[model samples]
Target: MAPDPPDDPYVLHARLLAADEAAFREVYEAYVPLVLGVATRVIRDRTAAEDVAQEVLSHLWERPLSYDPARGPLRAWLLVLAHHRAVDWVRREEKRRGLAAPHEAPRGDETADAATDGLVALRVRAVAAGLPDTLREPLLLAYYGGRTYRQVAAELGIPEGTAKTRLRTALRVMAAALAAEGITP
Candidate 1:
């Protein structure tokens, strides 16, 4: 393939903004490798990294306005986007693994502890199920979903402060309920 023109990124960006298909193709072919490399380095999983790279490229195509020429070159912007997406992927995987961790049987002779933990988890889930939806949503996202309060807020379309408040309220209600039921830790 011919090398990308040595034209200024601003010009290419303008072309992209104008919805020139050829310009977008050129940018995609030119920068995909670099973006993939950044994602692979951060994600450390080739398949997951490639997924992030594809998502970053798709986002660039769908939201060309997200890129600003004054910030830096297009290449740098693409690399940062790829890196952030890869990091987010890693965070989500970590959360999934963490949520499953408590359910896994212990590796050694801690069968008793594992059993106890399972019972506690069951009770917690039962308590959570009785919570109002507004309070339950944030609590599940933070505790079971392994997301931060900010993430819970973003996912639930609420302010971060509101997410925090709701999670706290849910926990307090659960605690009181558990105490009333004589379900002590």
Candidate 2:
């Protein structure tokens, strides 16, 4: 039997469910340039973008069930996937570059430290209460519970970069509020 023509994206998508070789080839050939473009725009490096594009396409090939034609067209879905992969790559690179500082807890003078810690806790609570839940939750998990950023992301069901960004925003808001009160963390 002759294999079906690979012109229609919907047909190709359906064929992917069976791990069809022709459909996979058609998808890669049709979308590689577009996916590479989106990844490069976000990553700002052609070589790394090519890696991202390859990973995204390979993910589609390996986990074809992850895609939903009902959500949107395959092209748009590929673009979104490529973009997310690119953003993740950029975030990883930023961390590798030490662009963000890690937060550390303070310690000293046990008796005096307890008293000052109580006051600081109250002030932190006041500032945190003013933040939106989306920003506040990850911050609390990472700081109060002493969770790693990745743990916070997993606990909150958010992307790791989003968790990091929200935590940064929350800290900034708290810092501004503390500054207005003539205090610094």
Per-model clash counts, in order, read 0, 0
Expressed as tens digits, the lDDT of each residue in 86-123 for candidate 1 is 65676677667784354343221143234334545655
Question: Could you tell me which residue pairs clash in candidate 1?
Answer: none
Please report, in order, the local distance difference test score of every candidate based on alpha carbons.
0.72, 0.72
Q: After aligning candidate 1 to the native by TM-score, how far in Å is the CA of 136 from where it should be? A: 45
RMSD of 2: 18.9
Compute each candidate's TM-score over C-alphas: 0.50, 0.51
Query: Distance from true position, residue 56, model 1, in Å?
Result: 0.7
lDDT of 2 by residue, 1-185 (tens): 12233566567777898899988887887788878877777777899999999998898899887775543456655665676567668767767887645542222225333433454565567668778999889988998899999999999888999999999999998898655433464
Any runs in candidate 1 off by more than 4 Å, and if so which? 1-5, 99-185
lDDT of 1 at 62: 83
The most accurate candidate by TM-score is 2
Clashing pairs in 2: none
